[model samples]
Target: MDTELLKTFLEVSRTRHFGRAAEALYLTQSAVSFRIRQLENQLGVNLFTRHRNNIRLTAAGEKLLPYAETLMNTWQAARKEVAHTSRHNEFSIGASASLWECLLNDWLGRLYQASSNLQFEARIAQRQSLVKQLHERQLDLLITTESPKMDEFSSQLLGHFTLALYAAEPAQMKADLNYLRLEWGPDFQQHEVGLLASDDVPSLTTSSAELARQQLSPLNGCTWLPMSWAKERGNLHAVADSATLSRPLYAIWLQNSDKQTQIRDILKTSVLD
Candidate 1:
């Protein structure tokens, strides 16, 4: 199938008029009609039903809409990735800001040691944005706390980390000690609500654990943090009953990707090891 025909079909679908689509594509109206006709002939179905000036997509056309757009976007992304590969063995990765600061830095070191010649592009985004980018083929790999249930993706365990409450001093039961709420997701919220006093409120709330860490000393506050991170700071100590909080990390990638074998090996040998 000619990609141009699909492109023209999408343009017509967007504008809902062949003449306007032709104008947008810099093609003659007749040429646009010819492409649509060619596509209709090849697919053995009428794409659009015409009634004078009013135009509407046939049932067959409506069915093909999503697939057509996906094909075009995938084609464009493949072309861009091919161009990148020609220049260098580039791998694009994305993760949450907290993950980047806590984990991805070490993973990058592992990547460099595995293949010094490989080029890397790393992005820090929330999990939702990372999933979107991964689906669009904009990111080759993701390091996240939870596995994506999408069929097109594959995930592997990257080990687990404990999230424990930490403060500038030893655990204190005082409500006025300046509590900072760290957003760790819904599970954390559910686990924490029962632990807090009914009228107690945090002095600060933030999504970034690093920000929480920075504020802990200044405000003389307490917040949940990964044990590995918290242990490094001498002034901070774990709060009472914080040992139960732990979550697994996952390394996810597009299933059956061109770099699947290489990524599998890299994750197994370098990062996970």
Candidate 2:
């Protein structure tokens, strides 16, 4: 089967509208219909049921979805592997936006400076999306604050960072302060519950620390931030009685990865501090 046909099928399945799929794939509507027909003919099964504006996958199409995704990911990985030269290598790394901002950006910079022939593809996304990519072999490594509890992958502790409550006024009472919540991770949330009162609701919630800091003001709110980051900003003052939390940063990859040595070498240069 031509991979392009599978690609078109996947796109159509995702959009559920031929016109939308065509727009996304940069093809004519007729061309999109032709590809779907060709795929259905090849498989000898009706992949979709078309009823006016409603388009839905048939049973066969639903069954093929997971397999199609796996095939596409495998093909992409194979192409990248085959394209590598003797002196140059490529790797794909993923992390959350905050992780990139707080830690991995510097680590990536160090990798580029030290490894002349190494090339990297960096993806910033939420933890769930990054984990999915890692599981599908679409990412070579994932950097996250929490370790995945799966046996199919291995995680190594890169370093630790401290998060502390910071406010515009150092003496502001916790009850009177407007709280801005940052989604650090599940473990951090568990730790946070003990530090905060049950009725203390966040006025604003965000996943990016930078955004949290930008939105904070003398009269607006206080939030948990990296101790190092908060100290650098002269306007932000540490809360006197707030509890400090320590978070471990981790580098995760497939246990049976072929590029383990290279990944290890790259991680050696990571400096979270």
- Top TM-score: which candidate number? 2
- Please give the clash total of every predicted structure, in order: 0, 0
- State the local distance difference test value for candidate 1: 0.80
Q: Tally clashes: model 2.
A: 0
Tell me the TM-score of model 2.
0.65
The CA lDDT of each predicted structure is 0.80, 0.83
Kindly report which residue stretches of model 1 are placed more than 4 angstroms away from their true locations once superposed. 1-85, 174-176, 195-201, 270-273
Clashing pairs in 2: none
